[model samples]
Target: MEPLNYLASFIQSAETGSFSAAARRLGLTPAAVSKNVARLEASLGLRLFQRSTRSLTLTSGGERFLHQVGGAFSTVQEAIAGVAKDDGQPAGVLKVGMALAFGREHLLPLLDDFLLRYPGVLPDWHFDNHPVDLVGGGFDAAIGGGIVLSPGVIARELLRTDLLVVASPEYMKGRAMPDHPTELARFDGIVRRSASTGRAKVWTLRHDDGDEGQALLRPRVIFDDPEAMAYAAMRGIGVALLPMPHAARWLKSGALLRLLPRWRGEAGTVSIYYPSKKMLPAKTRAFVDHVVEHFRRPEVAAVFDSGRYR
Candidate 1:
């Protein structure tokens, strides 16, 4: 037997999270699945799984190895199929994960152009406020901000913005504007609840002059979605801590007013994320390139410009 084939078994088990599940998927017994993974680990001189009686989890080296090679084999298959057909046209179900607000306001609008360019590809998009597991969930790509990069991924920044205070003109009509984050507690605050923790987030702010402050807010409205909180601010519910992508149009339209403009919460980068780039399938490659190039154009790029408040 080519011990090399066990590498595929290793990757499949990593994706499924258990030897039993991988065995069911691969039409093998759980014992065979475990043995193959153990052989692959032995061949590599590494411990791949931290095995327990009821579970299997990747070790640190296993995580890094997966990051480097997870989708490579399937991509090689796609490449071979392309060569056989004498074409490199992207054709596959391109699964994408995106944050709800940014996807709707930015990515969704530009997708028609991408589809036109890659007609062979089918887009499968999942938009939400929760975190995404790219490897386990089998997404081809994901787009959004504030994501902590997981074990097997890389992020290429498309845009960055500052989180600032925003409120509808109506909400601020008779109220004094906050000069610092310290004064934010006196006003009605609209804030976010952490999807992972279910607790309201604390605001740590920075001043242009380099002063800093933190606020533990008792929010009048707590939202799990960024766009919803921005909308709530626009409805005069309360002042919101919002990233510029969510606050930009309202600021330009005068529906919302920015307070303490010199002060901002942590700066953020919006990025397109994927697993290793070594041998990406044409569909994944095309969508990634298309989105990057789309944002590089002047008119489209201006909307995501950090200079707006700088």
Candidate 2:
């Protein structure tokens, strides 16, 4: 292998902290990766790692070397990718992270057309309701709301993810519809507990006139998933706070009814997150453009908009 290959092995092993894991990323055997690092050390006459039976830790020299060269190495890789992608064909595995329900209901429908357009690209998607480390986890892209923005990552907005309070017609059959956010206190509540914080979410509803009120929902049922909350609301469990994307379908089909149509909660947004635009891989670029274009359509945009639900 070339010296660059040895350096790449060292960097991957250092970042992941295990040769086996680095091997998976590099498409090499663990033994081969370890050997490449060893060769690189011999050539430089530097002990780069403190090796033991179960762990590998970088030495002072290794830390300094990595700090000096890591960014340049990444740039070199990106340049190579750019050159390959310049042919205007998007190919290879496109790894992405997304919430389960949103991926299935909204984005999955677009996959057939995307694949038909770019047959060379294969998608490897991970569905989780929580935020993921896009660069650290090696995801080409991720889709969701409230994903924290970090250096070297960018997002393209897809929809306004406004939170809506909704309940089934059956649940509200005998009860008078709430004319104000305060009246929501009278109904049962299907609340969402934050998975990361383990506390029930407190919703604050806002109106266009700059008035805001705390939605005082009595917690009769609780879930960690927004989709589950929507389903519970449809089954007459209780009035639930849900992001417009999750509740849109039900609201349109009359499975759920919106309450206090003038009020809504600001749930940041739903965006497609990806790496910096500079030298972006063809597949990643294509996928991002495709999704953004799809959402820009008037019919699709109206469906996910909170104002349309009113």
What would the per-residue lDDT of candidate 1 be over residues 122-176, giving only the tens digit for each residue?
Answer: 8999997665766656678889766667655778889777788888889898888
**What is the TM-score of each predicted model, taking all chains together?**
0.79, 0.84
- Candidate 2: the clashing residue pairs are none
Candidate 2: misplaced stretches above 4 Å? 10-24, 28-35, 45-88, 148-151, 276-279
List of clashing residue pairs for candidate 1: none
lDDT of 2 at 271: 93
**Top-lDDT candidate index:** 2
lDDT of 2 at 148: 77
The lDDT, on a scale of 0 to 1, for candidate 2 is: 0.88
lDDT to native, each model? 0.79, 0.88
**At residue 142, what lDDT does model 1 achieve?**
86
Candidate 2: deviation at residue 39, Å? 3.3
Full-model lDDT, candidate 1 = 0.79
Report the C-alpha lDDT of model 2 over 1-310, residue by residue, as the tens digit: 2888998899888877889867766778889999999999999999999999999999999999989988888888777776776366899999999999999999999999999999889999999999887765778899997787876679998887889999999999989998778788899999999877899989899987889999999889889999999988998989999988889999999999999998999877889999777537889999999999999999998887788778
Displacement of the residue 172 alpha carbon in candidate 1, Å: 1.2
